[model samples]
Every structure is written in C-alpha cells, then in structure tokens.
Target: METTATIRGEIVTFLQNRSMTINQFARISGINSGTLSNILNGHRPMSMHQLDRITDGMGLEEGYFYDLYIPECIFHTTPDWRRLGPFLLRCAELGKLGCLHRAARMTLENISYAPMLFDMAEALFNEDKHEAAALLYESVAECEKFQYSERLALCQYRLFVIGLGENQDENLQAAVYFEPYIDRLDDMYQLDAYVKLINVNISLQRWDKIVALGKRMGHKAKIHYQQNRYRFRTYEYPRKSVIFYILYSYLIQASMHQEQGDYDNAFYYVSLYEHPDWINKPNEEELLIIEQFKDWAEANRYMYGLMSGQPNALNQYVDYVDSREDEIFLALCNIMIAANRYQLHIDHILDRYKEHLVFKTQQNQLGKISDLVTLNRYTRLLAELGIYYLNSKQFDRGLAYILDSLEYSIRTKSDNGMLRCMGIFEQFRHFSSEETQRRYTELIQDVQKLSVYAWSPQV
Candidate 1:
C-alpha cells in the first residue's frame, strides 16, 4: 500500500540520516539538481536511471533502488493488462515479491484485471515465486469473493500447497477456502486437498481432526483402489495419486499417535505402510514415494524411541540412516540424536550444519518454502541447538541461535515456535549471570511484546 511519495520520503530520510543534502546527493549521483529536487518534491517521477545513480551515490547495492522504485513504477503506470502483465512478470522473474505485492495492492480496486492477474499468479507459482503468487492469488480471491469459481479454487489450492511447509495460518485459511469446494473437485484435487488439510491439522496438533480425516481418506483410497482394480490391470487399481493419499493418511495417523505419546499405535500405522502387501502393490513411482515415506516414518519412530528413553535408540537410528545423502534429513536426524543423547558436542555439529539451517530458515522467512512441516522442523532444530548450547554453558552462541530462531518464528508468525524460544530465554535467564540475566530478561520482554498470537501454556 505504499506510494511514490512514501518511497521518495524514504529516500529523503535516507539521505538525511547520512547527513547529506539533496544537492550533494544529486552532485554525487551525477543527476541534475533541478531534476532531483523535482523527483524528491513529487513534481516528477524518478526514472530507473536516476534511482540507480542515487543508490550508487549512497553506496547501496545494485537493485536496491530498483526494488524500492518498482512499487512506484507499477502504481503510476496505467492499468492495461497488456502493459502491466509483462512488467509484473519481469519483476517476478527477478525475484521481486515486493513489487508483486505492491502491484496487487494497487490493482485491488480494478477487478476487471483479475483474470490476467490470476494468469500471472500461476506463472509466478510455476516459477516457484510463491510469495508473489500468493499475493496475486489473494487479490484474485478477493476480487472473486472467494467463491467456488475455478480460479478461486485454484488460488486456494496453490495457497494451501505453498503454506503446507511455511505458514500454518495460511494453511488454515486455504483449508477453509477449499472446504466448500472439496466435494465439487475432481478425484485427484479432492484427494490432494485432503492430504494438505491433514498436514495442516498435524502442524496445528489437531489430533482428533487428523484421525477423522485420516480414516475418511483411508476409506476413500480403499474404495478408489477397489473400483479401479476391477476396471484395470493388476496393481493398477490404486493409481499413484490414490497410493499417495493412502500413504499420507498413514503418515498422518502415525504422526498423530506419536504426538499423543501412543508409540504402539504410531508403530502400527507405520507398519501398515511397510507391510509386504502394500509394498508389493505400488507402481514404480509409487514405490519410490513409498520408500521415502518408509524412511521418513522410520526416522519418526526412532525419534519417538529416543524421546521415550528406549535403549540404544540413537545408535540404532544412526546405524539405520548413516548412509543417507539428503542433507536436511540427515541434519535433522543428527541433531535429534545428539540432543536425545545429551551430547554437549553440539557446537561442532551445529557448525557443520548451521549454514544449511540458516539458509532454510531464511527461505521460510522469505516465503520461499511453503511446507510448514519442513519450516517447523528447521525452526525446532535451531531452537534445540540453542537450548543445547545454553545447557553447555555457551551462552553467547546459544543466545545468537535463539535470537535468530526467534526472528524467523516471528516472521513466519509461528506462535508455537516463538513461545518455545521465549520459554528457553526464560529458563536461561533464571540460571545466568547478572548481566546475562538482564539481557535475557530484556529479550523476553521484547518477545512478549512482539508476539501477537493469542497463546496460553495450557493451549
């Protein structure tokens, strides 16, 4: 919702902060003073060339001014889809979500452009420009009144998929948006929607809902498989889509049981996925997916074992997946194993994986990773590392990790994660030196002020 005037004002403030006058800035930027004054005073629009020169004059990075100027450009430009569409697409190609957001806000009153916006949104989504796509989709959804229109449904579905690994609230919103259209969707879309809803419920720890949905999905998959089997060749009854839904259902049930501390049921559900009959039934692609699911489920089972203090769980888990090459999965498994074993050698392990973790955390903050599950895992890993370092008496390093995690959690609007990090700070405060305690107390207060989510310890 920012305007050209706001951007110019920011530039003016930036120059003033550096104790530079507009004339000095214009001189250094190689721009005419009159033109600079006109642009600054809102009498003239700043060209990209002028903005770039000004950025250079201020010692800012390339594209710094361009990024700021994109909103102004889009806002002032006429609303012809033919002209605006390519410009928006170019911004997306350049990974400028801010520009897309600004354009969406600017075009909010122009519903006639919603179709073109939807197309551009899809293009952005296809290019993995999720935040940009989400912004446009949101605009489209608003224009469509979030009705059962195909575009609305598609927007809701994309938003749901994108939020799956990144934002629980977005996931919840997408789930609500898709609710009325679930029955009207085709089989594949319906199953996909159910899978996403189940994942969202899992992140929210809505166990009862997970169980209900899981059972329903299981039933649907069973019927789907049976009907297709009678109409098709051997092992082709359940297509890969149906197989995925069934596997995901099993995974959800396993997770739900694990959360409830029912390891037996958790193991039972995982066994269903690994059972010989189910294993022998999948097609090639389905088999690969099933194998991945098995590995993931096995990791969860091992995690449960470690949490429950079962003997040799860490060693068993290490021996099981020691050869795996998936960096994120291995990093997570290693951290959990180290934490469970009370290994104070967390510093070396963190040093080894910190960059990757930080990158993923940043991606989550930037809305690059839409999978809430993955985002949560990465956040939890950082928090656990923070806690481990604190327990190891490495206060500074621990605080750094905790603060980093807190920042990411806040950016993602993750109440659970923010509260967890805050709790860590509180616990650390009680055991720290006076100076450290004061710093931690201040941090705790800041976190409390920033946490807008309504959360209670009982919840």
Candidate 2:
C-alpha cells in the first residue's frame, strides 16, 4: 500500500471527523487553507508545525497526527461524503437551514455549471430566500403556458423568486420579457396571478402598481367569490391568505427600510410582521421553523457580538439573546425563520415545514369550531413532532407525527396546510395501518373528505 496515500487519507478523515472546514481549521491552527487542503489531499507532506496545528486544533495529543496521517495509502480515502457528513450535521445543529440546503444542493447535482449556480444560490438564498435559479420551475411553467412564450412567465417566476433589484440588467430583462403578457394573465390563476403581477411590479420598481395589485388581490375573495371556489377550486387556500399577503407587503416594506439603512424603522416594520399575533402564531407544522428561529436568533446575536468585538465562539449568539428577556428573545427567534420562509423555501427544513401527522383520537377531542385555531395549532404541533421524529429517521415515531398532521389537516378549513398535511399522510400511508392507508387513499383528492376531519364552522 502507498504509505503517503494512507497518511493523507488519515489526516483528511481525522480533520473532517472533527467537523471543521479547511478554512476554519486553517484559521484555528495558524495554517494556510490551500496548503492544508493540499496536504490532506496528499499533494504535500505534513510539516511538523502543520501537524502541530492539526493536533492542537483537534485537542488531541501528539501521536494523533501520525496515527491519522501515516502509512502509505493504508487509509482508504474516505468517500467525499464520508468527510462531508460532519459539515452537514454541524449546519443542522446550528439550525442554519440555508447552510444545510446549500450543502445538500451541492451534493445533489454533479453536473457542470452546477457548482456556480449552487454557489450563487447559497449567497442569494442566505441574503434572500427568493434567490434561486428556478431553472426547474421556469421549465415547468414554459411547458404549461406554451401558447404564450414561456420566457416572460419564466422571467416573472425568477423575479418573484429572487425578489430584489428593479433596474438591474437581468431583472429588467426579466421584466421586459414579462411586460407584454401582463394584461393577459388576469383571470388565469386568479389570486395567484395577482400575486405574481405584484411581484413583477416589484422588479420594475413600480411601487404604485405593486400596491394596487396588493389591494385587488386582497379583495379578490369579496370580488371573485366562487360557487364557493375557483377553476382550480380543488386547490384549497388558507383562510389567512389575506393576512399572508399583508405580511408579505410589510416584509417588502421592511426590506426597503433596511436598504435605506434605517434600522429603527426597518426593524420596526419587521417586528410588526414578526410579532406573534394570536391570529398568525405558527401552528405545529412550523415547529422546526420555530426551533430553527431560536437557533438563528442565537446565531445572529452571536454574529452581532463578534461585530461588536466579543469573542468568536459558538454560543456567542445564544449568550446575547439570553441577555434580553426570554419573551423578546423567543419573538426575535421566531422572526428570523419567518423572515426567510415568507418569500421562498429552503429544503432541509421543507419537510419540517411540511410535517403532516394527525392524531385521530386527539382531533376527535377538538369538537368545536371556536376551538379550531387552538386545536389546529395542537394538531399541527403533533404533525411537527412527527416531522422531528421522521427527520431523526425513527420510522415509527415519524409515522405517528404524520398521523397527527393528517388529523389537523382533516379538521381544519385551511386548504393552505393541505399541501403539507396531505403530502405527509400520503407518504405515511405506505407505512401506516392498512385502515388509515385505505381511508387516506380514498380521501386523497377529495376535499370534502376533509369536512369530517375539519372543524364544523357552526361549532
């Protein structure tokens, strides 16, 4: 066996096993990032100092370096993922959904241009959730709207997804493409069309139009009430869709203030939208988001501390947030997560956001409409617990969470949660009791089946 190869492999595996990146490790150990990478990859032999750095950084005794980095190729090079698992798991622990999503996305597509797109996506996603290439969504839309060229629709979708800059060449080009088809999309997707139009107006920096579309979409239910529904009536909407729209408007308003560097007012509006309104408090489906919110708030607080010259360490954010009252801290924590989810979604947390478990027995306990929101919240929590369990890969535990999500979905009038709730139930059906699996299969697309599961309006 190649002794050099074995030593290099061992060193790489050891460093990675500690969950430190080359950049992070290099910084910690007074080594150069590129040089460290080269050494780990076997291009450079370990210098005594470099070995010292690795060993010191790892908090291990001297032989640790030789143990890991000796013997020609005796170390089977760890698979790339074998090294990556630590980074990804660390990201998950930090509740850095963006980090986790970026890493997962990186691992997913092993194609040319994938790296560039993934890098750009990570930066954009971190700064703004709407930042995505959306090649997939655009392609799908083009196929759907073949009659009118899909370029504009695709552009509209992209602008909406990224949600920034009006005069930029790319954004303007997207706006130019979508401008022609603007008047034509009126009745097509109804409220969704209105939402898209508002998004397009935002790209063009036509705040007047953006505001007008918002008003119209807000009143759409009153103006366009269906035979109690739509052409896509099968698509259930959240009862709080208007509230959702309002929140979106305010977020954009907050972003505008933030851009102006008016931290006071920007944060004021952010707090307005972010405050835990009884009406808007997240139900159980969003518990991961809620938890992640705490993590990010802790992270942000830590970052702020570093900016203010505090020691650079993990619990930096947590320590700062703790200085604030627990209630204020929790509220801020929730806000961080909601701020991202408001525009687009990141994946690691998508399933957490989509937890679909229900408790038939507990749901039966919620017999009143007056209790709907509270009960829905409870059931949603149960669903999230399922999601938490499932994410842990405890198959049995996840199944139970899915059952709770389903019960909530069936009990609530919220069509918005359906996509999440139904989705989880569908996934769980295969693993659940045959009776639930059979019933859910029958109830699959039938919205009415939800009536029994949902709260009675009269109650």
Candidate 3:
C-alpha cells in the first residue's frame, strides 16, 4: 500500500508483486535482515553497497536505485560529507558517471563543499581515476569561480592535464583556458604548470607561446631558486628539481629560436643551459640534471650547426645521436630535414637508423615520454621523410610516406600536420600512382569530416 514514488516504496511494491517477504529479500540481497528492515522502513540511510545489493536482489541493473537514492537519501536531507564522499567514490568505481555528476552538482550548491570536492578530486586524480575526478573538478571550479584562490587555479591545472589527448585542437584550447590561472598558483606549481603548458604548445608547434611561457617560468624559477637556495624545506618542492626548470627554460628558448631559424640566438640560449658553473655545490641530482642538459646541448649545438648548413656538424650530430637511443628519432628527423635542404647524401645514415623511423613510446630516467610530443614528432618525421624522398626523385616512396603521415595527421586531428602532408602530396601529384591518389582523396574527405565534427555542437 506504499504509494509514494520513492526507493522504499518501489521496494515495497516489488516485494508485494512477487509475494516475497522481507526475510526472503534479505537472504537474496545478502544484507542482514535487521539492516534491511531499517533501510526499507527509512530508520537508517542506505549505503551505496546496500543499495546495490538490494538492486541486485530486485533483479534490476546495477545502479538501478541510484537516481532515487540521490534525491531521497542525499538531497532531501542535510548533505553529510561522511556519507556523500564514499557514495561519490563508489559511483566512480562503478562507472556511474550520471549519478556522480548529479550528486556532485547537488552537493556543490553550498560553496563550503568546494574544498571537500577539491580534496576528493585530488584523491581521485592521484588514483588515476581521471574521468571521475574531472566531474568533481568541474563542479568545484564552478562553485569557486568567483574566488581567486590557489585551489581554483589547481583545479584548472588538473583539468588542463586531464583534457590533453591526441586531439591537438582540444589540447591547445585546454592550454589557453588554463594559462590565465598560472600566475594565481604558488611558485612551485607555476614551475610545473609552465613545463606542462610548454610541452602541449610544443606538440602543437606553438613556438612563440613556448618562448613567452618559458621566459616567465625561467624568471619565476630563478626567483624561487635564489630565495630558497640556502633554506632547507624538504617538504615543499616542485615536480622536478628547481634547476630543471631553469635549464629547461633556456633549452626551450633555444629550441623556439632555432625553429624560427635564429641560429645565433638559439646558440646563445643553448650556452646558458649547458654551463651550470654558477651552482655553488651541486648534489647528485643536480649533477645528473647538468649532465643531461649538457648532452642535449651538445646534440643541439651540432644540430644548429648542421641546420645552418655546416657540413662538418652533420657527421658529429650523426655520431652523437647514433649512440643515444632516446635521441635517435628526433635526430633522424632533423637530419632528414637538413639533408633535404642542403641536398646532402645521407642514404647510408637513413639505412643505419631506418629501424627507428616508426612511431614508438620511450622511457628515460624522467619517465615515459609525453605521448603528445611523440605523436607530433612522428607525424613530422613522416612528412619530412616523404618530402626527402620526393625531392630525391623517389616518387613511390615519397607518396607512400606522405599518405601515411596524412592518415596519422587525420587520426590525431593535427591540422598543421595534415596540411603539411596535403601540401607535400599536392606538390608532387604527377608522381602519385592511382592508388596513392585515391588514398589522398579519401584522407582529404576525412579531413573535411573532422572539420565538421570539430564545429558541431555537442549534445
């Protein structure tokens, strides 16, 4: 006779319809009879676990009771973090995103819940539960939108990182959205944020943005380093050593300048990172950072020389990169570019490192290389190879490599990469076979579809 449209009423109706007793339902649900009685009679709030059990006992899909439970158990009463926190976590664990979103939305009405939600989001993010954490981060950010708190900035930062993926456009958008919040974060966070921001922009080939951000990061890191040099605060530190940021800033500045074909300025910045003689007493970690930067500097020195058409630098660059597994792909890429530009014969060099020409993941002492960085380099590598072969009058190899790059470009939604591939293919259309032309046509259609997809409003 319970006519109310509530979870307990639904349970009552179900039991009556099946002619099942409370004890029978308890046995089926594996919940204690006494506990089940309290849950049904509204004497006690049901936990997510018990609700799931009851749902299963009712022969309903998992989370069948989540919608009712939210309004009835959570929204109808004062929100308690003790109960709400576990429920949200369980929802995440069960992949019940709709319920999690609803519960978070309801709970965040009180701005006091923002801190708790942020803390929960941090926990979820650390646990690598990114999708669930993103919901909480979005909710918390909305709740704290009017505030200029570091927590708000942190949320934006986390969202930026979580949002990064194969889609270059979305990654760029995420970076732009989060860039304004960088100054609001603490110094340590700013350093880490700049590095991540730079990495994404690098993937997108935004050299100008990288140079600007790198300068800011370098200034902030230098300030922090000067202030904290003698102080001993082991508890607080950046994601990397402070020295890493300083050197990385110089490295990126040099890289951007080099990309812009300013080899003189590039070499100037390169010298700054290569020499760390200013450090009074370098530790093991600091020494390691210095060594790494020195290696990078050496390779880059040769690259700058070779890129500026220094004939002797080519052999040195090849010799250096040949011994380093991590350096091989990028070195080969730049070498190919140089070879094409200078009309240098590097057929032997190509034959030597041909095995490493494909896209792959790599790990170093730092960690797994950024997928964004890897993908960007791989696409560019393919395009460069295509251009190299085409310029060498190897038409079939050239078209095949170009088409492969174009396909990857479409898959990753890299507009610049796609355009580069398309332009390169069009330049040598007369050399393309019928099959190659067909593939190119199909890839162009895919690009058109991708453009439409990007512009279409999400439902």
Best by TM-score: 3
Taken over the whole model, the C-alpha lDDT of each candidate is 0.67, 0.47, 0.88
lDDT of 2 by residue, 82-105 (tens): 333443333433345454454444
Least accurate 10 contiguous residues by lDDT in model 3: 230-239
Deviation of model 1 at 357, angstroms: 6.0
lDDT of 3 by residue, 1-459 (tens): 543589999999999999999999999999999998998888998877788888898899887777778889887876788778888998888899899999999998788888888899999999999999999999998988999999989999999989999988889889999999999987767888888899899888887898999999988888888988776547554877788899999999999889889999999999999997777577777888888899999999999999999979999999998778888888988898898889888889989888998888965555677889888888888888888888889999988999999998998898888888888888899988898899889989999999898899999
How do the predictions measure up, each by TM-score? 0.60, 0.25, 0.95
C-alpha positional error of residue 145 in candidate 3 after TM-score superposition, expressed in Å: 0.6
Query: Which run of 10 residues does model 1 get worst, by summed lDDT?
Result: 361-370
Regions of candidate 2 where Cα sits further than 4 Å from its true position: 1-383, 434-447, 450-459
lDDT of 1 by residue, 265-302 (tens): 98998888765364445666666766777677777677
Better of 1 and 3 by TM-score: 3
lDDT of 1 at 242: 66
